[model samples]
Structures are given as C-alpha cells and as structure tokens.
Target: MENRTPIPDLIRLATTTADVDTLLQMMETFCHHFSYPFDRPLRQQLIRQMLENPSLGSLWLVVDENRPVGYVVLTYGFALEFGGKTALVDELFIEEGHRGGGKGRTVLQQIQQTADELGVSVILLQTEKYNPRAKRLYESIGFVDQERSTLMWKRPN
Candidate 1:
C-alpha cells in the first residue's frame, strides 16, 4: 500500500503477483473476451506459470477506494527496427460498472509512466475490431493504430 493513492493505486511490477487470483477472476468475468478453461485451479496454475516466466508479463490491478476497478498487463518486446525495448500491453480491462469515470485514463497514464521508467520507446496494444469505445480511449491516451494485424497458430494443435 506504499504507493497507494486516493483513486489510482500505483503498484510496481513485482508487487502485483499476490493479487493474481483477483486478476484471474477479472479475466474470467470478461467471458466475451476470454476463453476460460473453466476451473479455478487451472487458472491459478496458469497464472503462476505465467508469473514465473521473466518474459511473460506483469499485471497491475487498478484499485480505487480499495476495490479493484481495472487492471493492466504488460509484456516486454524488442524491436531492432525501433532500436530498443517496447512494451506490449497485452490486456487492459475496466469492469463494466466502472467504465466512464476517468479512472481508466488515470490508470493508463500510470502505465505510460511505467513504460517511460523502463526506457521503453513504445507501448503496443490492440483492441477488438468491434470495440470502438476502447479504441477511442486508447487513441486519446496517445496510442496509435499500428499498420499491422495479428496472425496466429494454435498452440496445442
């Protein structure tokens, strides 16, 4: 609680691991955006497995007035083209009930500050093609649309 603020608590990378369960629950709650495997234990295991990997990512929960309102997950990346480290904002979510109070913006600005502190040149993020609201939020916070799209392959197939 050292960096805790009145509305947006500022937590560093390492301090967030203890709240992994809350993070997992939040992900599961956003079922539309998440494909949950449906067992608490499995999710907990996956969360731990992720935390153990240095390159996997770090999660920060946005606690406001003592309750978690949103969260951010950032993973590191290197771009020889950009010539330094960049951060991929893998997931950012604010609960539906907490949607429009400027809390999201505050939390994101904190993320940007974190990126700056890490000497990262850019922050990469993506939103659903249909999530116009989210796109707008990101744009307002200086996140620009990348000229690229994602391509992927099934991991266990």
Candidate 2:
C-alpha cells in the first residue's frame, strides 16, 4: 500500500509552542485511555514554561509517515553522583498506531546518541510495572533500575 514504507521513517527534532496545543491534546487522550492524568490547561502551561527556559532541556519529537508518532522531553540537572548536568527523560509517548511496531527502541536509541553528544552523564526515566512492554524496551536499551532514588511529586494546587 502507499501508506506502508519499505524503510522505517522516524525523525526527532526540537519542539516549539506552535506544537504545544496539538501535543497537549494527544497527551490528554493518551492519559485518559491509560488511566493517567488529563489536564489540558496544565499541559499547555508546562509546555509554555519549558519553551521559555533554556535549562529545561529539549523536546526531541518522533515523527513517522509525516505525522508525529511520539516525543521525548529531557531536562538537564546537576547530580552530585554524576558530577555534571544529566538528562532526565520526563516524557516519552508513541501514538497508538505505532505501538508494538518496535519504533520505541529506535527513538530511545536516538536520544541516547544525542545525550552522549551533549556530554550528559546520565539519562533517567520512570514507568509503571504494569507497562511491561515499555519496561522491556528500556531494558534492552541498557536502563537499569536506580535503587537509590525514588521520585515524588506534588502537583500544583
């Protein structure tokens, strides 16, 4: 079919506010279906804030077939253990149609490459155990669980 490609076509690039509205809608739908969170206003505001901050890291997006397939947003932070600014992959989501297609691994590898180029000491992320498929993907990419740190968040009031 015309829709099918002989080669896997995926691209990752920086994101801008022009992409926030659509990304928020996608994130909202993803959260709701997965019993996650869906607050469009907050997502919009978060994206805006990240866009305005140079230290907030970059949004390396995943696109396939000319449409956004997913995104990886990483922020940098100084870690005493690492002794430098490390990257934390705060968000990574693939569109429903692209799931199980093995594109996650490809995108993740791309990010790792970028991290190395940036001289990042670490790349970290969190995911639920219920998401075994995702867990496996991370494992294959050499991500081991950090036994020392536990993430806690206080969402804004």
Candidate number of the best TM-score: 2
In candidate 1, what residue range of length 10 has the lowest lDDT sum?
6-15
**Scored by CA lDDT, what does every candidate get?**
0.73, 0.77
lDDT (Cα, tens digit) per residue for candidate 2, span 1-157 = 3783443546555566656765776777678778987777887877777778857777666788677877777888888887687998887888888888778888777777677777788888888868887887898989998768788889899
RMSD of each: 5.1, 5.7
Count backbone overlaps in model 2. Answer: 0
Best by lDDT, which number?
2
The Cα error of candidate 1 at residue 108, in Å, is 1.4
Query: Which runs in model 2 stand beyond 4 Å of their true positions?
Result: 1-9, 153-157
TM-score of each: 0.76, 0.82
Q: What digit string (tens of lDDT, one per residue) describes model 1 on residues 1-157?
A: 4985554454435345558868777877765555535577786776676678856667777776777766788888899876788788877777888879887778778887777667788878877787798889989988888667574668795
Q: What's the CA RMSD of model 2 in angstroms?
A: 5.7
